[model samples]
Target: MPRRAEPPARRATVRDVAARAGVSPGTVSKALNGTGQISRATRDRILAAAQEIDFRPNALARSVFERRSYTVGLITTDSFERFSVPVMLGAEDALGAGKISVFMCDSRDDPIREKHYVDVLLGRRVDGFIVTGRIFNEREPLDVSPGVPVVYALTPSSDPGDCSIVVDDAAAGRVAGEHLIRLGRRRIGHITGSAWFDPARRRAAGLAEALGAAGLEVAGDPLYGDWTEAWGRQATHILLRSCPEVDAIYCGSDILARGVGDSLRELGRRVPEDVALIGTDNWEFIAGGARPPLTSVDLGLSTVGRLAARRLLEAIGGNSRAGKEYVPCHLVVRGSTDDLPPASTGSAS
Candidate 1:
């Protein structure tokens, strides 16, 4: 039989670029990343050599030398949901734009799996990590991966030493509460997320505060449940029965808001007429095109993702990590709420 052709040799590397550019491997890296006080001329020559030789930097080896994997770990509980995809995409887009890679892990809300991912990601020397789900408040001082910069998407796990990005859920809730109050709805009910999540708890507090400021209280005990449509529907039915005079309902999320609308219809009540409804997660893409639109609070999930990614990148680049950062939320009004005639400014219900 004819001899098999010899396999092609491995591709050129940063070492090759360094040799062709008459510089060191470190210099080549500086040129590629565009930093480290290297002269423009030297950087250009190094880049030219790399392009000529088609040099591919060894990511794993480079990570070893620099104590950086240039890889980010994204750990989430609900990793496969529509709401989470935007956040993951945002983070991936930001990091990948900088030529970084990502490793994703799902905790499935299991504490054991969550802790295991922390160790696994750290073992891989990932430059940073992004966590989403519930804000972990470090109920106790648990040792975590040392030197790994971590940021939370919506829920911030409590690590005072770590940086985090969160939406002003309290502000979102307050806005929703005030809007209903302004619409002359005095009897308002609330369907909120479980107290275990900080965002949900804070939002509920804000709702209460807003109502209190208006010289009123929640029409009834706030209905608490998970952040799911099923819970929202169940909570809505209970609220209606418990607070028969309620004229408005504030749902914790757009998903819940949709359920609330459905339940209202089933109860022979017209939305906005018998019970105006509001929810968080503007969910414009999901709610916008509905026959009657849904009003919601825009928590800026993409913004949170982008901000967290940027902060992680900055930390990896040796920037000083600071305390937590809170991103603001905006309210998007739609047809789910009443279409009252325009009112003069500064007028309260």
Candidate 2:
């Protein structure tokens, strides 16, 4: 009453692939491992054979032979929030293309936790590391063995010798100021976060620089406060009270801009028609959700992550670069600054 079951098919092996490709096993190994000198034709033939037989190489065995785990450790202090997420995604995109796996760890701003993650990832023999966080301030270098490669993204390492990828904060402000200037807005007010933060100061300086180049000056000194909608609202009233002729306002963040916009509406000032608003970070959700979508500076967070990953890859390959590399910021046009419809997602030139 029982029926016989079919036998399981045998798995494909390197020898089978080599035989099918009419090449020696050694040649197949060379081709698959990307070692030694092999002609393109032979490599292609071996690859084709491996594909035809549905062959999958043993990752562990391959790693052993290559003496590399082909894995990277990504450590973040931002808890994968809005700032770090894009950077992480960009790093993943780059690492994935190299067939490298990533191990994500969150330090949550604790030194002990960061050290523990570093030790564990080192134990796993990850080929390299990418460190990222919310702020652009330089952080202490990651503690690791001498030979291990590490690239800092967004948040730079304090050591001048380490490679760091960062957004150009000054450029963000300069670009915003230039845009407002081009719109014939001579009286532009600056509203932003704390004065102690390096980025906030740099952005304020940049806005001043842009205004200066046009033989003009900001309507008033930059209103420095904590980064919040409430600050934005309060600062707006103050700025208007002192310089009611301010035709434009540039905020350090989209959240601040939203609050500023709300305040402007309450004060019976029409957006664009009366006072154009621009913000930083170009965070789509906050910028897009504003009554009139907010035009903001895109800090190229993803690009920072991608470049950091590339730099790490280079370091792993024995070609490392030191010092800081700044990715440029770009403007994203939106309803608040321009009369045109909302632009598509992501940063624009």
Candidate 3:
């Protein structure tokens, strides 16, 4: 064969793909990333051209061109908290797998820290924000940085349509309430975590529905407090004083259940016998270390994290059916609620 000249080097770009496909550069990107409101035939043509031209994405150049960091900002309270850690880890792993870098900020349960972190992340021009669970009321400082998609985990701001990944809190509470009732306990008390949090509110609502369905009222008003051992211990006393006849108590969290167990035993009560108990946030390894493991609702923390990250990646890749996503929860029964007769111990219990 006769000697031939080498092909000239040309930087691969959306423009080149557009030219080859007889379309616009905007159309080319939309097709490649599967985004933008475009016709299916046109998208197909652009994709075919991109493949033919061997277009490789230079993420660094793309970031510079778009004036973005291509990084996702994850803001959470209490990073060291056992439940939060698993969720954060799942999000990080999923994001990393999608070639996305994570920039994390811990609020440590302080609104000031939370606002500061939001400001910093906004300044960094992150592509998206994953707001983890924090107790922010309407009066709290709001972060309204435009042009970046925001995804929330565990909680969302008061505004509607904010994309979020959360477990159905009310459903979880209903599960707890139903379980106690099914166990033949007529008088059920409640030990709730922070009332300021929205999830706590939903849980209370769920508990009410469950009890209402069984034609039984809650033993008394729920003992409201934080999700701490101290509060759990304190609330147990209040619950007992308010409803001495209560035969079961649905705690807001496993930590609270642990405290309740301590209090019950101190008062000469036997778990699942004198007073059966149920809790949420099956933080089993840490909170359910008691002799008889605490029965709880598995809120699917890791699942929430993974789903949030996956949804974020999908958005970045141009899939835009974005809104709130909820992961369902199930009950994990242990010794705490085992007093139910063998015949009544259904699959859920």
Candidates' C-alpha lDDT: 0.78, 0.91, 0.78
Q: Which digits, one per residue and each the tens of the lDDT, describe model 1 over residues 1-349?
A: 9999999988998788899999998888888877799998999899889889888777777678777768888887775565466678889889988888989888887789988987887787777787775442433222366666677676665666667777887898899999998988888889977877677778888999999999989978888888787888788788877777778888888778877888877777667777888888887765685446888888888888888899888877778375678888888888878666322222111
Please write out the lDDT profile of model 2 over residues 71-163, one tens digit for every residue: 999999997488989999999999998889999999999999999999999999999899999877889999999999999998999999999
Please report, as a residue range, the 10-residue window in candidate 1 with the lowest summed lDDT. Answer: 340-349
- Locate the minimum summed-lDDT window of 10 residues in model 3: 340-349
Q: Please state the error at residue 202 of candidate 1 in Å.
A: 1.6
Off by over 4 Å in 3: 1-69, 79-83, 109-124, 136-145, 318-323, 342-349
lDDT digits (tens) for residues 25-82 of candidate 3: 8777777666689898898888788889898878887788766677988887755656
**TM-score: the better of candidates 2 and 3:** 2
RMSD of each: 5.0, 5.2, 7.1
- Residue 12 of model 1 has an lDDT of 95
Q: Candidate 2: worst 10 consecutive residues by lDDT?
A: 340-349
Residue 226 displacement (Å), model 2: 1.2
Which residue pairs of candidate 2 clash? none
Model 3 TM-score (2 dp): 0.73
Model 2 gets an lDDT of 0.91
RMSD in Å for model 1: 5.0
